[model samples]
Each structure stands twice: as C-alpha cells, then as structure tokens.
Target: MTGTVLVTYGTTNGSTARIAETIEDVLRKAGLTTEVLAARAVASVEPYDAVVVGGGLYAGRWQKDARRFVRRHSRALAERPVWFFSSGPLDASASERDIPPVPAVRRAMTRLGVREHITFGGCLEDGARGRMAGMILRSGKGGDFRDFAAIEAWAAHVADELGRA
Candidate 1:
C-alpha cells in the first residue's frame, strides 16, 4: 500500500534530526511519500500510515518530547507500524557496547507495542552552538559515532515493512 510515512524526531543538538532526515531520504528514494517533522510539531498522528520516532539520549534517557509523544498517542500508535530509535553513546568503545534503553522508556515502548527499537552512537562537537552541552558531553568522552550504513539499512527495512503492509 502506498501511504504517508511520518518521520518524527527530537534532538538536543540536531544529530537526531539529521538521522530522521536521512531516514526520510532513504524512504523517499524507495518510492515512499515521507514527511519529516519535529516531535513537538506533531499535534496528532491522524495523517500517517506508519511512524518512525527518533531522539537523542541524555543522561541515559531519550529526549522528553519523544517519550511524551509516544505516551500521549500510544493507542493510535498501536494501530500502525511504529519504530523507535535513540542516538547516544558516541562510540563503540568497551564502555559504549550494548547500552540499552532506559527502564521507563523501554516499558513505555513495550506497553505501546513499538515494532522496533534501536540505539546508535550519537555525535558531540567541540564548538557547536550547544557549546556548553557539548563541553559537558565531552568532559567524560566525545566522538561522532553514528554509523550511516546501519541507519540506511534500518530505513530500508522500514520501507520494506511499509510496502508489505
């Protein structure tokens, strides 16, 4: 079925927005109609056939808006194909391996029946606009650890699933 795909995201310093846009681009290239929107801009889920929600992680949690989006629309979301992704943990160092979603967020996803959930390395820059936040992020560790290939692959999978449904 040909239908609208909503790519909604929350980002602290725009990395997650970039990821959301890239997913939208991948879906568009695969002949799907897509709309990329900030989570706060989404007043309702009425227009979408499927949804992909993404956000950056901070202090071991998904962005607040993202969690609120799913929590507020859980029932409507349960009726559609939905995917969740988190951007955090800058690299694949031993310390960053297998970092899972936070407990409350994981429980919410389970309650909402989210089709898929992924955690990928996020980026932290030295002199970016959110310089203070970036500095704090770097005080412990820092890197641009996103894997575009994996992101694209996941987008492809979402497209395939949408095509099937």
Candidate 2:
C-alpha cells in the first residue's frame, strides 16, 4: 500500500515516544509514508490510512493522554487499520516474554478491532518525573529495558501487514 501511517504515542518520561519514533523509522525505511506525533497532539486520525497508537503503562493503565485519544477518535479508528502498543516495564519481563495488555486496553482493542497489540520494555532514569518514579529510582528499579531489536521487528511486521492490506 502507498498510504501514510501515523505513529502516535503517550509517554510519561519519553521512552514510549522513542519507541514510537523507532516504529516510524522502520515504516519509512520500508517505503511507507509516516508521521510521528505525541498522542495528545494529534488533532485527528482522518488524514492517515493506518495508525499505530502506543502508551506508557502506569499502575496497570495507559497514560491518560492515550486513553483520552482513543476515546476521542474511536469512530475514525474503528474504520481504519489500527495497532496498539504499551511501554512500561522497568524490568526485563517485557523483553523476556509476551506481556499482554492490561484489561482496559484489551477492551479497547476488542471494541475497535485493533489489528494487533504489543508490550515493550520501558525506561526510567534520573530525571524522570513523578513521586512514584522517584521511589522506584531510590529503590534501584529504574533503567532502560526497551529492546530495540524487538521493537524494530514488530515495526517490520506492521509494515509487511500494511503492504499486504
């Protein structure tokens, strides 16, 4: 397909945004037109042929901006090829195995007929915001756990699927 893809994401400390950019890069490299934007900054999905939405997981829920974005654009998203991803596992679990979406994301996916969903490891560092983040850092759990190789593979898969569609 020769259509543009929008890669939008909600991030707390920017790791999820990085993942979204990574996806955008792969799609572009595969000859697909693409744009990467923060989830909250997206005014509409009507301009894109396909979309990939991602959020940083916190307390078992997607970042507020992501949830709001989905709710706001449900109708448009339902009519298009949409994929979902979550980033927020300050450990190796996400990289080590398949981490399913939280319940709310699952419901949204089913409701919107999302093409696929994935969970990638998250990153938290010294300057991350939030009290909980500070606590996690103090407790020695903060680190960058995102597996770029896995992220690239997933993006490649998305590009392939989009081509077939």
Candidate 3:
C-alpha cells in the first residue's frame, strides 16, 4: 500500500505545482516512490498507493481543474491514503478575511478519506496574473511566501506516516 505516492496539483501561475514537486522530493528522500503530475492530466488514481492533491486558490475557490479532478476520482481516491493541500495564501499573517476551504474541497476530503488539509502560503510575482490580486490582498512586498522548510517538514512527516502503512 505504501509503494507509490502520487503528488498531483493544479495551478494557475504554477505555485501549487512547485509545492507538489517539493512534496514529491521529500517523499522520495524518505524512500517512498513518488510521481508528480498535473491534476487535469490525471485520469486515474488506482495505480498509486497514496495521493497528495492540491490546487491554487483564487477568490475563495480552488482551481476548476483540481476540483474536477477530485470529483472525477473521488471514488478511487476513497480507497487509498490521501491528503489535501491548498496553496494560495498571500500573507504570512492570518486574518479574518482569509478564506476557508470551499465546500467542494471539504466534501472531497471526506469522500476521499483524506488524512489532513494543509494551507500553505503562495507566491505573487510581478507581471504574474496575480498582480491585480496582489493589489487586492494588500500584502506588503510581493514575493515568494512559500516556506520550504515547513513544506519539507510536512512532506517528511507524510513520508514517515506512510512508512508505517
């Protein structure tokens, strides 16, 4: 059951894909087989022992393709180990305006038997589609906000947990 881990994600400007890659690297370092793919391209979940799926968040919603991926594979996903992550927080600081998980993501978590849902900070590069969004976020000093150490630690923890499987 712990033989292979699928790290899949959907992204608008590519932050979620980067996060998935980081996770894949950590899982591989922990000795678990791992593969990274875009959510839209994933037609099946049956080949993998475990899965980690995430997507870019915009306007309080996950990317459409990632949501569809979950809906399409929810049944197959329910049969395996799973975790979910959302990569789109602009600020390191938490606030009341910060969005919560969308209903679809919540439902997918339950239906897919997901172990956890982690929300990570995302990047807002100049000239990226998020420039307008960055202005809306009012997040000071637009730059990559992703915490690689935290991501690596979480992925390592996932690897440890799956090692027990």
Candidate 4:
C-alpha cells in the first residue's frame, strides 16, 4: 500500500496508454508512487506492491501484449493486489452502463484472484491501425469514447483501497 504501483497497458493506437497514464496521474496525485509503462515493456511485477493492467480490446479479447503480460507474470501478480481494465467499445455504452470484462479476462481474473476489473469506452481516431479500423472509420463509428471522469474516479477508488491495505 505504501509501495510503488505499476500501471501498465497494451495499446495499438495509444488510446489505452493514455488511459493508463491518467490512472498513474491520479494515483501519483493521491500521494502514491506510481509508474506507467507499456505492458510489453515491463520486465517484472516483483518490485511493485500492486499492479494495474489494462488493454485495448479487440474482437472480445485483450490485445496480444496484455494477454502475454498476464501470462508471463501470473505468479507474481497472484501474490500482489492486481486490477484489470479494458478500453474498447467505440461507443458510450461503457459510460452508460457497467461493461463486464471479456470472457478471457474474466477467466484470468478468477484464476489470479484479481481484485477488480473495469471496462472503459475506447477511442478510434484518424490514424488507427488495421483495416477494420479504417472500415469502422469509414462507417462513421470511429471516435473517442473514453470518459476521463469515470477513469479518474476509478483510479481514486483504487488508491483508496490501497491506502486501506
């Protein structure tokens, strides 16, 4: 609780990374030590007292890097307080209602005894990768749907929980 927190995320077009950075900012502002990193860049979770893992959802699954990160750090993560978040759904659905984790993420959470998981609205802008992204953009569905207020509130909650720990 008084130790460092790792806020790592996997993102393709950088939307999820922004979300993770926002989380890190709130955690740091709460007087907690926090580091934000790309999930593929984190080498270990052992140095942190808690971890927050996030990813951009694609096809009902977390991005490959996030999935691999969880798989690689399962043991260490299971020993520490861990939270998961997903950033996808290029609509206001996430803000309008509680969007549950994708099936794979739910299973991972159960297996790791993860404390909580949240799904935030995603972002898709002009330069997003993948042909599907272009298609979605062409179809007029691509836009920034992330809710910063909700994100900050969630981060504050995490900080509160950690303070209690």
Candidate 5:
C-alpha cells in the first residue's frame, strides 16, 4: 500500500500549507512516501500515486492556484486516489451551517469524481497580507482556528482508504 502521495496546497497566509504538511506527515508515518508542495509549484501530477489537494478559502472560494491545479490535472487525478480540502470557517460559530463549495470546485469534483472533500478551520494573522484582504472581505476576526486533531483524523481516514485500494 505504500506509494508516493502528493500533498499540494494553496495558502493565502500559510495556514493551508501548514495543514498540507501535517497531512504529509501523517501519510509518511503510515509508511507512505509523501511530498508536500505548494499548488503553484506542482507542474505535473504524474509522479504520485495519490493526490491530496488543499487551499485556503476567501469569499466562499478556494484560492485560484488550487482551482487551477485541479483543472489542469483533472483527468490524471481522476485515475488516482484524490482528496480535496479547504481551510475556512474560522471557528465553530461559522460551522453551524454547511458551507457550500465554490462553483468551480463543485464542478471540478463532479467532473473528476474526486474521492473526498473536507473543510477545516483556517488561521489568520493580524498583520499578514491575507489579513488585509480579510479586512476588505469583512470576514470574522483573525485567529488560528485549525484543529490538528480533526486534520489528523481526516488524514487517517484517507490513509485507510488508500490502504484498501
């Protein structure tokens, strides 16, 4: 079951990148070889057996780079185990209702028949560039909302799925 997994992410202020690295660690610990790279840095998906794509959310949408990554490799990704995650919904308050996936993401998932999609809370830095964007967005107050336990649990589930495959 051991094989290469690519954990690619698009982050606005680095929260999603951190989440991607955590997933990479989980896969490695499960005896799978993993490479965590920025979504924009991934020129090809041919090197990996499975793909984990992640990104931060802004205005109810995933980062552009993440969307582009999926669009560019949708066919190849459909032939492999693929997981999608979004870093958003700052806290529990924001999670009370189900957030709809962006139109592009929804369409991509249907077209690619992606394996799974998860949404995790995002972190925002006070002085970071994303913070400025958030201010303009009129989103929630800034703070780290990423739940490591939830992230780890999701990663474990992905590993189990890959193992079964």
Candidate 6:
C-alpha cells in the first residue's frame, strides 16, 4: 500500500538523476511518500519501505557507485521490494529495443532478488559527457532521447505493484 519509497540513482551528467526525479513524481502521485537521492548519499534503507535504483551506463557498465551500493546493501535490498534500471543508449527509439543486462547488474539483481530491470532511452547533451563519451555522443547521435511517456508508464506500474506491499 502507501508507504515510504526511496528512489536513488548514480549519474555521470545527471540524466539518470532526472529519471529518478520523474519516477519520484509518479510514485508520490500514486500515494507513496518518496524521496530521491544519489546512490552514494543514501546512508541507509531502514527508513524506506521500497527502493528504486538506476544509473547511467558507460562503456557497457553502470556507475561504480551504484554497483557498490548494491554490493554494500544486497542483504537489506533482498529483504524488500527493489527495482533496477540503466539509462543509456543513444538511439532515439532505443526504448523499443531489447535491453541486454550488464554482467554486474545481473549479479546485483540475483543478489538483491529483483527480477525486472529496464534499460531506458538516455539523453546525451553537449558538454555533458567525458571526452570520449562526448565524441561518441556527438557522432550524430546526441540528443534528449529519453522516452518520458514510457518512463512515466513504468513508474506508474511500479507504484501499482508496490501498492500491494
């Protein structure tokens, strides 16, 4: 039912944080008390009833802070409702494509007992990426490719599912 939800993320240039913010809106609207924070800043999950984590994908990997967050809290996370996501993929229609899991995420999910993970369309704005990432992002593929509608829908679904908690 309605309870406290923690929505935290790790982002390189803030895109994944934005996703976490949007998810917070959806969850709050669905009657849950929600808070958003950075993965590294989250000191504990003892105050939360559910947890949602997301991160930016770089070089086929999720943010280190996020991975560490999982490793550090796997036991607690496994005892609650948890969901994971990765935000990267320059294709404008990438949300429609299949989401292949990163090896680290696979282990994290297994350890945390989470079954569903999403790969959302990511945003790549100028001056927001590292040198090499900027190069790849600037290769005629950079833009705000995030599918907000899909993201909102996913958030709504999560809220509904958590309502049973």
- Worst 10-residue lDDT window for candidate 5 reads 92-101
The C-alpha stretches of model 1 lying farther than 4 A from their native spots are 93-99, 128-140
Candidate 6 per-residue C-alpha lDDT over 12-125 given as tens digits, one digit per residue, 9 for 90 to 100: 899899999999999998888999999999898888888999988988999888887887788788988999888988785557776876888988888778857888988888
C-alpha lDDT score of every prediction, in listed order: 0.83, 0.96, 0.83, 0.96, 0.84, 0.86
Clashes of 3: 0
Model 4: per-residue Cα lDDT over 30-50, one tens digit each:
999999999999999999999
- If both were scored by lDDT, which would come out higher, candidate 3 or candidate 5? 5
Query: Candidate 6 local accuracy as lDDT?
Result: 0.86
Cα error, residue 80 of model 1, in Å, equals 0.9
* Pairs that clash in candidate 3: none
Residue 109, model 2, lDDT? 99
TM-score of 2: 0.99
Give lDDT tens digits, candidate 1, residues 1-165. Answer: 588999999887788998899999999999999999999889999889899999788777788888788878889898888898888777774134655677776887788788887777788776545665677666867768888888898899988988888
**Model 5 stretches astray by more than 4 angstroms:** 93-100, 130-140
Cα-based lDDT at residue 27, candidate 2: 98
Give candidate 6's error at residue 153 in angstroms.
0.3
For model 5, the local distance difference test gives 0.84
Q: Tell me how far the alpha carbon of residue 13 in candidate 2 is from the true structure, in angstroms, after superposition.
A: 0.9
Q: Write the per-residue lDDT of candidate 3 for residues 1-165, one digit (tens) a residue.
A: 457899999898887899999999999988888999999999788889899998888778888888888888988888988998888777774222344566778877877679988888877776566556658546555567787888898898899889988
RMSD of 5: 2.2
| Clash count for each candidate, listed in order shown | 0, 0, 0, 0, 0, 1
